[model samples]
Target: MAGMCCGFVGEGDSSANSRPSRRRNLDMLPFKYIADMTVAPSGTSRKRRQADLSGKKDFESCEGSNGDRGNEKSKKNKNESSKVSENKPSTEGNLEDGEFPKFGVTSVCGRRRDMEDSVSVQTSFYEELFHFFGVFDGHGCSHVATMCKERLHEILKEQINESQENFEWNSTMQQGFARMDDEVQRWNSSSQTVTCRCELQTPHCDAVGSTAVVAVVTPDKIIVSNCGDSRAVLCRNGVAIPLSFDHKPDRPDELIRVEAAGGRVIYWDGPRVLGVLAMSRAIGDNYLKPYVISEPEVTVTERRVEDECLILASDGLWDVVSNETACGVVRMCLKAHMMTSPAESPANNEVTTDGSDQACSDASILLTKLALARHSSDNVSVVVIDLRKDQRPTSNSNYNLIN
Candidate 1:
């Protein structure tokens, strides 16, 4: 077994600022994909992942793609002439002709000063296996989100084994979140060099936390565990099916839960728990204690033949783009992918390492660009997984991923 590096964080990720940013992309109009991305193949089940950093064979793979707004702008300009900007595939990357991209991700700084959002994707994570995709929106700092990127999947894997056949969705997810929260609390309590813009002391640093939305895709089911405002949306038969809901403070049930737990929801511009964090449930934020809990709301959905794709993203995208609209955009991209040639596929398209199905990648890049164009105030991150069974690789394919 190798360590995983499925998560990637943008430099300008999450900002704790609750105020809406009105910054518009007047200059970078009609954005093209400038995301620094390293996409890989999801074909075959038992093959080992390529080593990311200098480490042992039993190491987890964690890959990060860095892209600056300046760099993106410059690159965007050069590629503006070409309808679709393409990056050469990694020499070692492999994908059969016509196989849909297993997943596509795009994360950017948006209007924020620092990057705090993280994305994780792991294919065939276990034997008799399943695939994993997660998005964590870090506020106050990026450590919590980074930690979750590194450990949450491992924690949940243990929980799954502990539960065995009768996997208690709520219980398993709850335990995983609790263990992750504990780890964050310990890390935040210790003395460490601060990296993010929020230069708060240890006492204040304890206030930092992240929103987590994780999806585990098995052979027949999609299980989602969510805390805070991040979300997982399943597109089936062209309709949006929300797998995990945002845990905002103002949500009726969440408001009641916070109040019952001796917390207050005050409107400091927008509804927030105790007029602070906008979301009621999060991974860290030890200062909030029992008020802002870490218990996750879990949803298990059986896979359907009409399934199109699964979308997981941070609030940066969801804040401006509705689930229906996001699904619609993806559907249209997929349709265009089927109809158009690679050269004329999209205005904002990035080539994946394996020359993956551009439909998913195009949709993700477009969504991120849309969020920025709409002046989303936070870091934007999106993952699109093709759910059309026909697009998936056959059982005999053994394509390996390269970092």
Candidate 2:
């Protein structure tokens, strides 16, 4: 595996389970497992494995357009007497109907490596204006990531629906991760698991796992849930505030938990749990069960008028780009579009064919390209969400905290 170093630049850069029952609490997302400290046999995915798992479940699985954000806001602000139909795109508008919470997404296979990464964008799962975005970085194989790309949101939607009666965002998110991990584990052990495409000739199998970061944008709040290192950052008033914490083995809390679980963080190339997986939590990788967990840390932040956008990405982009730099780049891109086409009206699903508007539409693609240029070693995946509406900031001087 290529070494991925962590660095922060100054303003510039640079689930569930299947099988047996165990006492698990959805309230606090607690994880308990029977202790077995035996080392995994040579050639297995995990160098260590816990025996006869109990008191918790095994890892497993479950389950975008741009102008989407701005377009919706325009819809709400449209003249009351206007004849524009709510169901269709306007002939005179630059955006398609219902495209608000605009999305820009892109992904690329690593240099000479299998593209195990997967990204997803979902709009209007619960409400016409709601949105969900995620980036998954798979290790070992793409199967687990693919499974999550397909079903995580669906399960999450179901959980959210159930929570509507009571409305506990954090608990709902935590439950969703636990349930999804179970599904992934069951699939990994099932006969349906297939061998994913590999270009680097590295190891690939169902024993693989993926790092996931997800953001759900509602009218009032942005709820983010993450496991492993993929991240979600909210660009509010030109500053990037992290919404979810990365679950890395070397992190103080993570290191303490690993040791308590009888696992050691070894620095072979970088800090890794049991000298293997670099992440402290993830979906799948059954061999790492009871050591590396599946519980997700979730955050619920209320939306604000000062919020500019939300960025969801794999480590491919974050490893090389600083939060401020990313926020600045995206702000500039959106600002350019606003200046180039100040009179552009929101149309129904209208596609940007060329120029700066087109560039804004490809925000995710542009971010991925930038990461690649910086020599990111892992497969790259990015999803840029335009959370602002009305007009672009006139200058950097306009940025200020919402409070």
Candidate 3:
């Protein structure tokens, strides 16, 4: 019922003569977990769920030595760590305005189902300049979303490292997501069998899952990977260029794949796999395994000078806000902020909050507000990354965002 918003802007030296700055806002909006996340044995049937759980014996009797207990403890600690990071707020006051330019992120919990959503922005992973951002929207429960938030980036980095000379960005992204799902599968299996008394209170672990839309901003490119309905849109020259597509069950390719897997695609509200999960791809939902996949579709795009910003958000925002409408609002705010205080000179090349930074941050907040105003039935989360690193407002602020 309560919602909070936080904004951060990465600032750096802006020079008109220097090659275009590598800065880009990678807005990773809301995500849904994998179809095979953690499955309740009877996910497809309410009657079966009751029947299966009632018949299954408790694994508590299987507990053995302190070594097993230690493993349980370690696993619990890992889950806790993930939770803390997912809930970590990137408030303006806490941001360090570090040396490397980074993204400004903002999020809001929509008045939809007890806020089964999690979001994260990490500027410290790997080399500091390589930033990652995402929004994970949980369904059935937030467990899978939280887990992905805590671990996906780390898994991605490890996979990239292991690939070494053979590193192909798209392949690495696909593989990273695959590995992340595998890790989640292992965790779920361990939790069921280990009989950890400490985790009895774990919430949102039923047949719950999440969708992921992630953006990694590197020195030369913006890499986006998406599973499920979440999305990423780049504002190039003020035009909306979608970086990822929603993986709805009815999408022709997705439908074919689901049917090929021996899964039925039936219309229930919207097209659903086996008339269960609405999405064709996700991070969790064990019953939907093989039908709902975790393989993320990846896009690698070069950074451009006319690139205004990037908007990443869950379907809640996209459901109500057209990509063009979202871009227009942000571009307008950025230009206005830059032009508002022409008399004051920028210190170094930084876009001071007193001017454009504040405007940009406000724009991020406005996007979240607009989604809520539209009464989106799903959780709404958004991140806005400023790509025009050094451009300050001049008399031409009114010019169209694109040539």
Candidate 3's C-alpha lDDT?
0.58
Model 1 scores a C-alpha lDDT of: 0.64
Which ranges of candidate 1 are over 4 A from the true structure? 1-101, 192-199, 341-355, 391-403
As a TM-score, model 3 comes out at 0.68
Provide backbone clash counts, one per model. Answer: 15, 34, 24
Q: What TM-score quantifies how close candidate 1 is to the native fold?
A: 0.72
Error of 3 at 306 (Å): 1.2
Give the top-scoring candidate (lDDT). 1
The order by descending TM-score is: 1, 2, 3
What is the number of residue pairs that collide in model 3? 24
Candidate 3 ranges beyond 4 A from true positions = 1-99, 192-206, 342-357, 395-403
User: By lDDT, is 1 or 3 better?
Assistant: 1
The list of candidate 2 runs beyond 4 A from truth reads 5-99, 193-206, 342-359, 392-403
Predicted candidate 3 versus true structure: per-residue lDDT over 1-403, tens digit per residue: 0111110011011221233321121112222211111122533321111100010121211111000000001111323333322223211111222223324444444443234556665543543335676777667655677778778888987875576454577888899888878877767666454332211234324355788898886545678999988889999986899999989888999989999999988875556777667678888776578888999999988776677788788887887899999998888767665655545633224434322235545666677777767755565666677666545645754565423
Better of 2 and 3 by lDDT: 2
Q: Per-residue alpha-carbon lDDT of model 1 for 1-403, expressed as tens digits?
A: 0000011122232333332332233233222222333323466221222111101111111122221000011111223322221221111111221122245677775555556777776544443235567788888777788788878888887776566355466788889999999988887777776665553445537867888998876645678999988899998887899999888788999989899989998876567778777788999888887889999999988777788889999988888899999998888776656555445643223433343446666778788878776767676788888776433223324432111
